[model samples]
Target: MEATPTRHPRRWLILVVLCLSTLVLIIDNMVLTVAVPTIAEDLNASAQDLQWVLESYMLVFAGLLLTAGSLSDKFGRRKMMIIGLSLFGAASLVAMEATSPGMLIAGRALMGVGGALVMPSTLSILITVFDEAERPKAIAAWSAVAMVGLVGGPVLGGALLAQFWWGVVFLINVPIALLAITAAMVLMPESKGPWRKADPVGMVLSVIGMSALVWTINELPKGGLSHHSTQLSLVITVAALIMFGIWETRSKSPMVPLAMFRDKVFTGASFSLVLLTLANGGLMLVLTQYVQFVLGYTPTETGLAFTPLAIATLLFNTLGASLIAKTGTRVMAVLGLLVIASGFVVLANMTTESGWGVLAGAMLLMGAGSGLAMPAAMAAMMGAIPDEHAGVGSALNDTIQQAGAALGVAILGAVLSSTFTRHMPADAPQMARHSIGDALAVSAQTKDSGLLDAARSAFTDAMSATFLVGAASVVGAAVLAAFLMKGKNSGPVPAESAVDPATEAESDAMLTSL
Candidate 1:
């Protein structure tokens, strides 16, 4: 059943609660980066252990997202959300008390489980709460807040690390969760799906497919693509994906409707979103290390440097909503891609002498580019779907984004790492370049001045290469947007459906729109 509009009219209040939850989720997720060294020293963890600490949460979270969304549809959105928030808060408490790497990782996985619940429900709730006329504005507002969470994560994590212990990063979630839980109870109406059967087999196949695929990609730097283990992983991943496709096609209650791909708007929107994320996701890791290791900025200073992206994203993100209404999707998407390409070109030339003005200016342009493209992309994907499939569609969107981010980091990070290792001076002393392998391996050793200088210069070259690559990706996305996008004034899809349609008609129309 669809949610009845609240007579009380507290839409903004509900938005606030959801936004707070998003910020808390993102902050907790990245906070460990600032505290990794401290945690490793205190817990006596190995480098592999540290890797697992990050991967475990993401793996379980991405693996189970579709299942969680299906569960929420079978149950109720409000009910699932409350359960998720409460579980996530409890997981945070467990994380705070973790004395071992394994314990912390387990806690992180639990948090991911809770995160799966919150992710789809939050998007679905907004769709239910807003009327058709106001949805574009609501989604734009929601997307802006979500983007803020992304840009602010590391900055907030840095600030927290400066003042308190590593545990403080996880502890910070407590109050935000409390506020969201309380607000959701008061302001949000309970809603459930036009319910459908849950597909256990499809869920299993999706998890296996995504996990194996990600694992294969992540293994590339450690073991070359030709390694037997790598080849095995690739074979397994491909097999799982093929099985998933087959199962999804046959399943009466598919998690992600296979038919959505038939629509050019859906196909283009989903593909572009993934490609953009692949180019964009690894940027923070590159930029942060460049500032601190190469240029020797303190953590606090590093946090300050990201302010431009934070601020500009907010500004342009708000403007993006308006621009779409006035201009159209095709123009906004194409312009955004061009702007992003320009930003990457500038970033590609970065050096040790680069000042805040140049770096911040580039970042500002990137923020604006992301701000412009994301909402339009989201609109296109959602507009193509019917109301009944909102939960599934939201889950699929988040899944692609999460998986794309992981792959982006793996691919771009591997490239940067390989470039650094190949180019480093052979005469460099052992102590100076002790950790010289890839991005993760060598980032730890960028302490001594000689090594720092080498890494910095190497990173500059590597970053330039990556940015050029990203520019190319953005340009490609622009091409896709130009061809597939309907119009800027037009929502991502045709508008008649988003505004008013019966549930069956909505689903049928989605099938016809392509």
Candidate 2:
């Protein structure tokens, strides 16, 4: 008789520890974005420096994810997590005390390494501790914690920026990391796959390929296809990824089980998530800027403005979790995505005269759609992955979402910048044409309120165009989900789907305590 994996008695407690680990990562990023302008002024940093301050972390984090995930599966998952938490806390201290842009950038890069290690282990460990029957609720709770981070990050950052130095933002992460590490050490059981040969070549290739790919995407909108830097990065990205694919196939034990892609449900879920994240990324990027630059809201007010979206998302998460078993993953995904597209359409029509009411309604729709869609899609995708490869599988999902969001930021940002420039008055000063920030600053110096009006108008026009693109992308994702995903995806992936039957019992026995 086949062994059934025993559910952990303290699984819910473990989930709480996992949420704390995730909270530090999510909240820090959101908080950092809110503190950007203050950091620029305090450090006397140039535009490029600020860009690096953000992108450097993402680049390093994405590059190391697959390797970190694999290592977690090889070493103890809980051990890797504690080490990651310690490193992240130390790095946050370094960043907190940074005296210059270079110092802060270095600190952020180290944190990226820590983040990569911590991130995949959380999901993989969650899957190990929770059985399929309980997986949806566990995931819903985990995801809801992310919503809390999203909501609280800006509010906390706003309060910190108002009272303390910008570095106080990083300070919050220290205690949170310490608490999570302590709890994880006390409560979490270690989990790992059976001993296998390390694929060093695969690790190197994946890092280089993913890093280059992200860099290429980041640069594409800024430099265009013809630029030397973009071309070079593109070449490196293609070559390294192709070589990585070839190496994985021939290797005795591959870093990734590439055969998993053959499953239509997995492929479909991944594709849909990429597009969904793309749309959401664009929306958040543009909306945050609009609420501040165009609407003339304080940073704190802007943070408060997002509360509706978070609330709506939280409520729908519970609703979706409750309904998923009956409706299947495909229905939830399609319905949620369409609602998101509708939200985008609403936001696209927003004019300078439109008050917070319209924007809030659109945010509610976006949140509701996301709450319904994300957990279902993730549940389906994670369900398809085998138990032994859980860590790497989680990393793969993260990579897909990260890449998608990065692409969205680049593409939508470029569109906004270019469209703003075009819509600006021909007589406007060169410095004021590309960015609303620059425009407002120029207007202040020149005492030209007409320039202010022009900038705001141009920005609204640009925002509308950007949101339309987001809507189209989400609509495409909706269609993809409808056609590609199949069957009821609420249950766990079949045991025979990937693993060897001879080792199944042993794997279940080890994983039950995970």
Any runs in candidate 1 off by more than 4 Å, and if so which? 1-8, 226-229, 429-452, 487-514
Tens-digit lDDT track of model 2 for 1-514: 9887777888999999999999999999999988999999999999999989998899999999999989988887888889999999999999999999999999999999999999999999998998776777778888888988987798889888888999998999999999999899889999998888899999999999999999999888776998998999999999999999999999998998888888888988999999988877777789988999999888789889988899999999888876666556666777888888999999989988889999899989998998888887888889888888888998999899999998898888988999999999999999999799999999999999999999999999999999999999998987777766664443333344423333334433432332
Query: Per-prediction TM-score, please?
Result: 0.89, 0.92
The TM-score of predicted model 1 comes to 0.89
Best by TM-score: 2
Instruction: Give lDDT: candidate 1, residue 70.
Output: 72
For model 1, residues 135-196, the per-residue Cα lDDT tens digits are 55667778777767766667787777777888988888888888899999988988777768
Model 2 error, position 37 (Å): 3.4
Collision pairs in model 2: none
User: Per-residue error at 253 for model 2, in Å?
Assistant: 1.0
